[model samples]
Target: MSKVYILMGVSGVGKTTLGMMLAEELSVPFYDADNFHSASNKEKMQNGIPLTDLDREGWLGKMSSLIPEWQSSNGGVLACSALKEKYRNQLAGGIDKDLEWIFLFEDFSIIADRISKRKLHFFNPDLLKSQYDTLEPPDYGIHIKVENSPEESLKEILQKLNMPEFGIIGLGVMGKSLALNMAGKNFLVSVYNRREGELEENIAQNFVDKYSDKYQLQGFDDLKNFVFSLKSPKKILLMIKAGDPIDEIIEELIPFLKTGDLILDGGNSHFKDTERRLEKLSELGIHFLGVGISGGEDGALNGPSIMPGGSKEGYNRVKDLLGSIAAKDRLERPCCNYIGPGSSGHYVKMVHNGIEYGEMQLIAEFYYFMRYFQDRSPEAISKVFTEWNLKQISFLLEITADILLKKENNQYLLDKVLDIAGQKGTGGWTTVAALEVGVSLDTITASVFARNISAFKKHKNQVRELYKLKNKADLEITDDELFKSYRSASVINHSIGFELLRIASVEYGWNLNFSEIARIWTNGCIIRSSFMEKLSGIYDSTKSSHLLLYPDIAEKLNEDQEIFTRIIPAILSQGCPMQVCSSALNYFLSFTRENTPANLIQAQRDYFGAHTYERIDKPRGEYFHSNWKPE
Candidate 1:
């Protein structure tokens, strides 16, 4: 974005000379406030008389009014001796937000020596001391020492004027934490949050107030000031809520921005919406990136898995700073990467959440089996999960173990919590995307349904009173057996999610790198686990669209398949709903089977609606319709 730059200093500080040079280099118009001075004021300075603030009021007002007019027509450079605080404020009053000031100064002797050589100027050399006494140097604007070469001084001015390298809009938990993360990496950061909500009265100002002394961070409440604070081709990350709010913010922010500025949507936005926004912004010469951020608040503060997708050049511009703030893999590579073109970053993140839903549901089922069917206490279940975590380390399992151990008033906190689970729509998005891509995501889909079923609390209570449910205390399954079942379900869950990505990658021309996605997930995501670390290596070595088709993974599945065969029926016999596990087993069985009852369904379709079925005895592409009754 463009801005009006003001060059301010004492008379002999070379403001006019440097301002002219900078205007030429920037290809903008230049103005000298000295030429706008009143004839009476100049005459007093010429006769060694100092002008009072009263004498300068009209002069400052006229110069201030010219700022907005100059800024409206491509930005302009103005040289002025705005020696007093009030005078500087007056000059900024016309266009308060988009003005950047550069202050040039030097030793008194050097300035005096330079002033002595001037002959044609109207101002008398005797008045130079009065100008110095009237000066009130600002602490905020870019300050450059003019004792250096003019070229060096100009270079310093330009460098210092590019105040902030990164800008973050919204200062919510995730946004606030992420801004700190970027600032921790030594990147100059500009943070903005609208002062509308009750809690947002001074959010950005408060953030800068708390941390500015420790880091190079500036905060702004005004959108225009925030937008203008960033350097050219601004890189901004929007960490606000997704949906219409994001679009509204973009609309409000666009007027202050210019072409080539990049905006990244870092919320859990629907990929279709991301695709639409990307196309719209591209037409306006503004680059839009759909970035998927995971690992929650703590991860955002420390290091999270960052998935960014958009224009290649746009990614390149912010990749370094993002990489510096992202979590590192075992080999010390950042978890952040350019995911793919279009909305693939959000797409991958949606699938990631789908797999998370499945894994969480399966873990919850494990807890239910132990607490209800096996009559184990919450403390005992915590121990079971802790032991299981040692065997198959995962973020979900680790947290589950921790959650079960939490107590309030000497009672297990898990007992007091409601059973109904909440979803944030990404899992549903994954299910919908799976259907659109023709991928059977039964494991993840079952998880989404399980949450929906939990939400029908009233109906469930009515059914509970109507029918007596069986308690399977007599049914004993060893921890080893339960872990095996859980692991088996999780494997299928991940496989289905990856298969969706594989198909969608082809459908959308994303050409996604499965290994890189897995690699990034190894450390900083909710699903991070030793299994993902292994899967990363598996994808690096094997070339397969389906994770189950990899020889190593298939061998592991073969070893684990026997436990599912026994446990699935046993668990279902107790009236326990093992949706994720049973769905996974059914999916596995169908995928492995050479033939299925789908042929009968196809025949039924053909008999009823003329949706023809292929003939097994004929070539693969040959199809035939059937007439059931007439034939």
Candidate 2:
């Protein structure tokens, strides 16, 4: 243990006890900041007086000076009331990232109760209010709730400190890559891939043979050995398939895992399935985390946005490890956070995939206009995408450019590839969830429908032969107009997805931080872009769940609507489907308008079936029935 550990919190939050326990576990020296307090300061605190900042300056400086000495000597743990940001900075001596700050937070009444129970402590229990008032919790650092036992807290701290002590149950693309990533970060990584047959090559062992020389990696074919190899409070990440496979693996591992062991499902499991597994594991005293990892195989190897929900205690234990392997946002913060509890991670990931589908379809519509309607060659279309990528800056846009550029045998490979698109159910799940929650996801639903229609290639070919549909000639638009239209549609696409997230957050009591979600999606994920970066700021500044209602956003939409409205119909005139674009335009039109034809629909319903309709002349929520045949 060569690192310095600072347990920072208000008084009577078990900092000293945890610090001493951690120090003993690591065989290091433990220093209590109270031991260095001046006699007068202690006397004032004993008389129920709170010490001012000026009074604690010297004590903090003394503790700061001892940091280098302790670091030089093996290591050390210090329990200090580093409540304020300035106090922690002073103690860190500008080396903030080097020292691990474990913030022990609990309810105010709990701290007050513990302080009242103190027999001979110099600090006054009455000064607890002043202490809490002075406290400014840092956003950084490892946060550990003080509700758990000291032993449990110590276990979390030690597990976080011990790098590379992680196990991966599956050595598939993501599993192997992530294992290497963790090992590359100096984690002791244990990997196991189940061998289905006696003659089957050991995937885990093969992985070790290839990369173990460069990294601290071990492979196990035996399930029990892999589970036993990890340190206590075993942190195992399962990168297997979602649904039944996840449940099967859990049941197999249940016998080997202990009471406090942690399991992280790093797959796109359904939120409901994750919730059920969480409840089941809680009954067995096993912690389960639904971890949504995005950015494909490459992102998994390098970095990706990680969303983990369920068992906050389990999350805290592995936060350091995940943060080490996750991508960085513009400010260089790790793109990983505990996204509330009970399967919210999977829910967010599902919406992210839905957004991805919409974005991909929008980009495809742009390509279709350029290639088919404008009759541009692949090289020319690739150039167009290159320019668009400069302005739009998204993973899908960048990859679309690459796909257009790829050629084999003097022909574009994209042209030879099948027109049908395949989906893995996440996008459909998102649409179904929106329907269940009464949220409109028109653009995402259209994207999913676009894919579904693409799958009917044979039927479409027959229909094309019967109708002889031809793309209209001489249909052209300026690049600037096209870009504006695409940008408008993209904005609407995200608006619908986030609106669903907002409604679902309320329905499920997730209390999601929209800004944090945007921040994390700004990098690594499939939808990463400068646009997402702008969105993160918008979410923070507006502090509103409905993104379309943000003043600046609404103003921009108002400006862009003219072109967006004209271009979709123009593309449709040229025989391009542009379903997502059309859906986006309709969604925006329906949402922004003050009145709609739905009033007539309500009248028709009331006339036919005596169903109720709200009166426009009366207050809202007042219902009236009409009968057309009663005359």
Candidate 3:
């Protein structure tokens, strides 16, 4: 998706100067319309003659012919004094390429002064009035005031197009927040939602009313008007539900879209579905982007970690816009980039959710250990979590502490919430993908299973009454020891998640950058923490297969492994199910061990099914069949 920009206005309005500056800034070529004029036309203009439409037909045709060549390459900026409506229509109307008309507006007095100072120019200052008289102000182009310096004008032009830059569908919480975020950055944003009922219309109107004064925001109830309001290379972002609703919207929007326009899905869509959509849309010459947006509602309002993947050219078209709205890390780098081709962004986000499930479950286990084994109240447990957070534990731990501290009518609010945690299926997607890729993601898998187990409240109650079990153990560990064990468990959980990403990257050809992933997650995300910053630094310097294999991480895990060993027995005896933490500990042990008992399992397979096994005496890939089954 290359784009052509035509800078248009009456003569002496500084279109050529500004067009040259814009071309230089965008790294594209610039062409002055004067260069394409016939020598006879130049001579006539030099003699203060106003050229009629007949005299301009050849010049306009030449500009129109060059459109395809520029679009096939990196695109070009052309400075032309296309004062008549018919002239602009001849130049840009019905073109297959994306052509934007940028009209540089200037006051008559300013134009007169600029022209009076101009030396060696063909157009006379006396002819300026005639030029203005012939000018038919464009109803479709971007009008930029030429009062500011060229650099400032170009800066404004790049960020704020004449028409709305984004047309956002589905005005839910995330959609509204993102619209407001883009508006706050001085972008013209058009927002829409399906007109389901009076309630839906009111919701959309309320959002527009709230921010219309502060930013250039518009709300449209009619879909056709909304689509018409957007500029070319249209970027329509869908923040609707993941499955059939998205398909429904696309089907409705296809009639309003043109070739090379982009449709970005910012929901937690299934990766396979995204891949299918990408292929389907590409057949029509439309680009479909699978964008992974994290950070929840608050993050959407402020900044969020954005992962966009689909067509590379489509990403290039919106790169600057995404960078402008994305959250910045401590180093002030935008936490957004082109993840890869196809559905890689959604895949990465799925794994992120899987890791989040593991992390939250581990925190729950820690809370249970404190509440049951140590007999600690909510406030006391919150205090411990707060202390660990100050030591750079994790954002999840920090938020958990705050959640525990929240109270209503002097009673803790968390205690009143339901025990059953709801999932939107991203965690399940990650677990399934791990199975497909032949990777071990046991800690995350256990976390997903834990959520299922929590749903069986009736079964648990019946089993508890039938057994009448009374196994209880007291934990006498110091707070420091508990904190170390928690930190070690957190590292192991993240390690498994990153290893899953590594395996999937190879299996799917995503070429995922582990360091960038850590960097982007350091802020504006649910799992953000100072630990991610450290992980980024470690990953940047080393190419370790597993995070635990990193020397610094290995040392920390080894130092805290003792604490985990001493505390697990006490915590488990009190009937606290440490699913995620216990699984992480086991995975850590298995990963570090050089040998396991899998040889016996292989022997049993060969004995029963005549399957082959590799012998120690033979080189790798050489198989031997066992005769232990009396075959």
Candidate 1: segments with Cα more than 4 A from true spot: 1-162, 197-199, 541-543
TM-score of 3: 0.79
Q: Candidate 1, 340: how far from true, in Å?
A: 0.8
**Model 3: per-residue Cα lDDT over 199-236, one tens digit each:** 67666667899877788888888889898888776889
lDDT of 2 by residue, 123-229 (tens): 88999998888999875456788888999988877765554368998878888888877888888898988788865468888889999569888788998988767
TM-score, one value per model: 0.77, 0.78, 0.79
Task: Kindly report which residue stretches of model 2 are placed more than 4 angstroms away from their true locations once superposed.
Answer: 4-164, 198-200
Each prediction's RMSD over C-alphas, in Å, is 13.5, 9.5, 9.5
Give each model's whole-structure lDDT: 0.88, 0.87, 0.86
Model 2 clash count equals 2
Please say which candidate is ahead in lDDT: 2 or 3. 2
